[model samples]
Target chain A: MTGTITEAAGAADASAPRVREMSMQQAVNAALRTVLREDPRTLVFGEDVGALGGVFRVTDGLQEEFGAERVFDTPLAESAIIGMAVGLAMNGWRPIPELQFDGFAYPAVDQIVNQLARMNYRSRGAVPMPVTLRLPSFGGIQAPEHHGESLEALFAHVPGLKVCAPCDPQDAYRLLLQSVRCDDPVVYMEPKARYWDRRPVELAHDPGDMPVGRSRVLRRGRHATLVAWGAMVHRCLQAAEYAAEDGVELEVVDLRWLKPIDAEGLAASAARTRRAVVVHEAPLTAGLGAEVSALVTERAFGALAAPVERVAGFDVPYPAGPLEPQYLPTIDRILSAVQRTLEYKRP
Target chain B: MTDTTERTFALPDLGEGLVEATVLEWLAAPGDRIGRNAPLVELETTKSAVEIPSPYAGTVVRLHAEEGEVVQVGSALVTFAVEGPAGEADDGAAGQAGIVGRVPQDGEAPRRRVRLRPPEE
Candidate 1:
């Protein structure tokens, strides 16, 4: 069932009423539709977004209402799409482009780096690329090649672009709008496979309300901290739930923003738990999880109860449909990592 | 030597090397003139809806299949008739362009930038 749309329109506004449960993809679609209605500057585009409503039906019914000119589809050009977004943002239009799948985003690397990432810095703050690239990311969907990738590090490494991932439907609804309204370009990574993951959600239409570059501590536990974002957050939570039966408590943090990370929140959390575990779907070699774990080790070295741990996808190409399960970090892997960290004796 | 050409249209890898695509609709019929890489057919894959470009700068001599049909890798989708020569148009391996890299590989450690820590209690 549909929930009451948010009455408020920006970050300065207060929370409105609550609503019923909705799928994450639907929540995101609602947010996009609401934003387009409220703001004339908002534009949504990507391949198949106009007619096919996207591969996952995320953009369903948008073109019919907004018209193809507003919510339109583009030629099969990822780099051109992103580059065009930079131009549109420069012209004061808010563009939310869909990358279709996380794995398929590689072709736009040049545009993302050369234009999208450094738009502000390149323009010396004279121009702000208010573009939101929604990338439906991660594996476990049993998809074919270029369908199940998690390339957060590729965006996070760039200085100008802000990287964010939402853990649940609620976050997906809110942060998506926030990403669109932000002054800087944001790569909003959604868990592609979890599009149908349902949860109780309250909707809002506001922008400029949610703070960028912040992480939310989902559960409070003293044993250790389990940090994850996007789809991995659910996995981490599941691992914690199963671990709790075995007498282990874990503090879970959903890092909504990957870039300009909430170092303060993380440092404080590490001080309490005195241990850390970072999880992501990207490969471990030079991945975002490593960057986070390194940050914890560097800043909160004295607050350590155990070595910083990371649970991530293996360092090989995300396998085909059948082998994808082995590629992603599972509950067993996370729990074992936590156990290993707990059993560590400081030497 | 006659003034005819055989341009073989190899299905382009729609960015992620999507091995197969479903023929959603055929925009051009047989014997239709298609520019080089002009969209001859529309394809719906698991990734996105894509327009299959005409690999040859010639007339559409034949269409390999019908609408709503599933096409496999290395299967010929269309053939074009060129004007000048009697040689094969060397359309290289179907390549994907302007794509976003989405997945991490196997056998490698997955890297994460955010470490979870306990909140202040």
Candidate 2:
């Protein structure tokens, strides 16, 4: 009779989840709200985060509800913002600090890359650096100089920092909540371009359900696989939509966590289709695309019908104003790369 | 003889890249006269609940959406029977992008929004 017991836990966990239509900005706001309500030791602070509700309004209404003590604003100093987080995290507090923009994070690189990234290792696992650094990253908002930049390659290169970028509203909420709850230092990159994009988000998924360092194949295809994250993930999905009209079904993979890159999942997707194209907004030379390309080539070399293609930004600095469109890879560019992979010859 | 004009005041962008909101409640009904800066409708955006204001002193000729109805930005909220010509109501003044950087546009948005970090099964 004891052996007759079946594992119905998976079915119970799959009970109807709450699916609400929300944008990435709203999802982030919800995540912060949930954290502040659940954890008394968690604190949110940054420039214009309290009263102004962040420039993107991602932290909107947290101050009004949580009070200034828990959700407060800091001075317009990036280093101080991150330094404060390091101090608070050491003192039994979980601090979520904001750098305003991707370009602004440079001022805090010393604190982030040197101190924060090394604290846990320096302490030999004694100090758990529970700090979540929120950064509005990547281009496409036509931001002026020092507003839009892609720093994933820099952060992902860091040894101890956990890097992740959500591609949709649901992941935005779940991943942020998970990152805040993590014991290590997490770099939470909020895509500035997809903040307003709306989609039906399954809201009932708890933290750790989709843990960090995992990739999801959004669309399954046998012809070729498209790998991307952040804003480029949506662009790749759009390219797949257009390719479907031409009887070409492209598999799209969303690598949510950049740092512990999901090599197994990336390789599986590449091995299945025998053709893989990695797309990103970062520059091509030494960009994250190169790392992804190398991972794909290393893990799935024998299964490949062609070499992995990377459609990425140019090596020059991220252009400003009207020149961004030319610098960032377009849907046409991704499709062209896919076409090349499909038409590959032994020559 | 009273000569009047009508202007359709659509929902303006609520800032922070929000494209639509659900009508929580409507303060003024049709045929009601209201002044500028008057509280018009309470909307529940994804962020928080906000009350919109009437543009100018005008007679409300029509209510475009009922309570609990989701209204898209740039869609008509209320048509006003006012005492001025078209383009004078100044309803679009609130649609300016509040944050730094380029604003988000609908369908094929060149200056679209982006997110980072990081999920799903």
Candidate 3:
């Protein structure tokens, strides 16, 4: 089924290719439009998604172009919305159910963990749950309670769900397209803070299919490997620049696929640098950073010059508007962690 | 004086201070006999799509708004003719009165009041 869609996409790309500067949110909308046009089985629905065009407007104008049946709104019941997606995927429809916000996803976790993630395994590959649960995550937008959270670790821990958090517009567009085509259930986490960050992206030519579970080395360095994903990738890059002043080089690796986690690429980078720092917005305890640190220890243990350091949010619940900046991983914090890793010596 | 034989069911404020909603589809049309608490129309608000039930049990005489039309809260949605005596019309109105003009207090859960059920025999 995906093969035919890919062919159709390839044929569509033949006419003319063009590049456009768009925000991450716009890129997401464009990717959704492209997928909907190429695939008939795909349908998008969530709270206020139709006329309201989604709270962040990431789904703006989709309902108009696709019509109500294709891109419509659902009742404000998160559990029912996701449960329906599970059933829809089981019955041959590719369902993209948006959770609207990160904290609001907790109600749907039961369906996500028990039904969507385990469907293929339970059915022994007889039923393919091509369901993409899109969630706008992370803080910094002064949103009300239950609106700001970075719970990627929660979904990443689940065995069967493929978690992808794209940092920039280009990856946002490409990753979302790939997620829709994947046969397994995917959790597409969009960093709410980076939604409106505009960047020049080539939209004319299809970048072709990006293989899942691959990491992109944004910057190459020798002193230490700095690993980050989603919004924190940009922060890591900034920290790398600051570290360069002190003659400490840091290679920034963007773990695009949070679950499969580009382990080989990470290991290779860690092996070269022999030092590592993992960064994320989630709380320090049980965050995705710990998993990355563990992977480095397991795969590149012999090459390590220092214990893997993690710069992440505190264990406290995401604080109110004023405290968000202090709560998230800042460039200073990341640089300090990198310095700590570089200065460490075995006794 | 208000008419005792008929009642107008206006679009309710579905909480969150929402003023208007696009009428997605009308489940019951004019001349259709709908029972109390039966779904009359599906409305698309800024939060979610919900079915607005008929507050009064009677024949739907007029559907004021077409599908896809945005109707403001407190505006008439559907008119219904009373099945019983004129004096009982107020009772039907009273029973359905809570549907409109009620605002949720702070921290209150949004209104999800449309509970569709088969007409009582």
Candidate 4:
């Protein structure tokens, strides 16, 4: 009954807004439909986005609804996709281009990091790149090489681009809408694993509910805080719930925005809990986990009770197929990290 | 796993002590009712194109390797939901029955023929 399409008690009433149980895919599809319907200048284009829908069928019926000119496809070229978005953005068209997959964005790094990301500053505020590049990112689906790489650190390190990944269907809908509306070039990373994740989404279309660069606390606890983003957020929440059964209170913080991370939000929770553990799918070295741990340590050092722990992927290449379960941080790994932070002592 | 009998057939020796073969095409797909000795997949090893025969009569459950993948000798090629006894997997002693021709995948051409298993007794 969770993922099945269910109607609320009030049948066909016009009094209240509809609350539908939708998968992240349907929620995002609805968001795109709303954006395309509302804005005339907005154009959605990318590889296989036309008749093929998408590799994941995320853009299932856009071209039929919006016509060929507005929702179209490009040749299988990632660089050209970003280049055309910047050109259209300069010409007063709001462009929302899908990079197809996370690893595919590597082919367009120059267009992303150097040109599209920095064009506004180089042109001295004359050009605002209102381009939202949707990249289906992260692992857990055991995709082949170059299909499931976690490249958030690469994009978040860049100064000009704003990076954000949403965990649930609600965030997936709202953050996508917010990313499309923001003037700054945003790399909207949708966790590929959570695409089919079902949740009751309030279809109010409030993109302004939570702005980009803000983090939200999904669960509250006074012990250690499990900080994570994207697909790993759900895993951390599971660990928190499991920890609660053992009389251990673990706070779960969804660090939604990778870039411009909410330092105050992290410090506020970490200060109260006195311990923190960062989890991510990317490898540990120079990863966003390190950044989160550093930020928490820097801001909450005085209030901290123990050292911060980071449970992340091994410092090796992201493995494919059968090796992935061992590579990814499991719920037990997160619980162990929380236990270590809880049991730490001064030597 | 319990309800259906399945066999994960591995790539057999095409001929002459070959180690690997590139899958050129799949002649059978999942849900297709396959008969024993039917053309299962086309392969190229050492510059020869060859087709491997199915070992059991069953519904194709899954294809372990995709086309163009260089599957190693004795690696999983296909899994079939067959009708058979609850018997233990045969050991590798009778793995190489006879090399009729050579089969290759990934790095070269494919040719020749080698039965995956003796006809079900």
For all the candidates, what are their Cα RMSDs to the real structure? Answer: 12.9, 8.9, 16.4, 13.0
- Candidate 1 Cα misplacement greater than 4 A, ranges: A1-18, A205-209, B1-121
Cα displacement (angstroms), candidate 1, residue A176, comes to 0.5
Q: What lDDT score goes with residue A109 in model 1?
A: 88
User: Can you tell me which runs of candidate 4 are displaced by over 4 Å?
Assistant: A1-17, B1-121
- State the local distance difference test value for candidate 3: 0.80
Better model by TM-score: candidate 2 vs candidate 3: 2
Which has the better TM-score: candidate 1, or candidate 4?
A: 4
Residue A217 local lDDT, model 1: 92
Off by over 4 Å in 3: A1-17, A204-209, B1-121
| Candidate 4 residue-wise lDDT, B8-102, digit = tens | 88787664223578999999989999887788889987536888787776799999998999998788888888664536333322233223422
lDDT of 1 by residue, B1-121 (tens): 7487676665554533344679999988887887766677888887678776665677888888788888874578877788775534444422321223222222333433323332234
lDDT tens digits, residue span A25-135, model 1:
788887888778767888999988888787666787889888888999898899888988988989989999988778778898898899988878978999888899999
User: Which is the leading candidate under lDDT?
Assistant: 2
For each candidate, what TM-score against the reference? Answer: 0.72, 0.76, 0.72, 0.75
Q: Specify the CAPRI tier of model 4.
A: incorrect
Write the residue-wise lDDT of candidate 4 on A1-347 in tens digits.
12112222222356756778887777778778767766788899999787767766678788998899998989989999999999999999999999988888989998998789999999998999999999988887665666567898999999889999999998987888788878899999988777767799876656565777899999998888889999889888777766766777778999989988999999999999898999999999999989998999999999988898999999988887547778988877777777777767778
Worst 10 residues of 2 chain A by lDDT: A1-10
Error of 1 at A345 (Å): 1.1
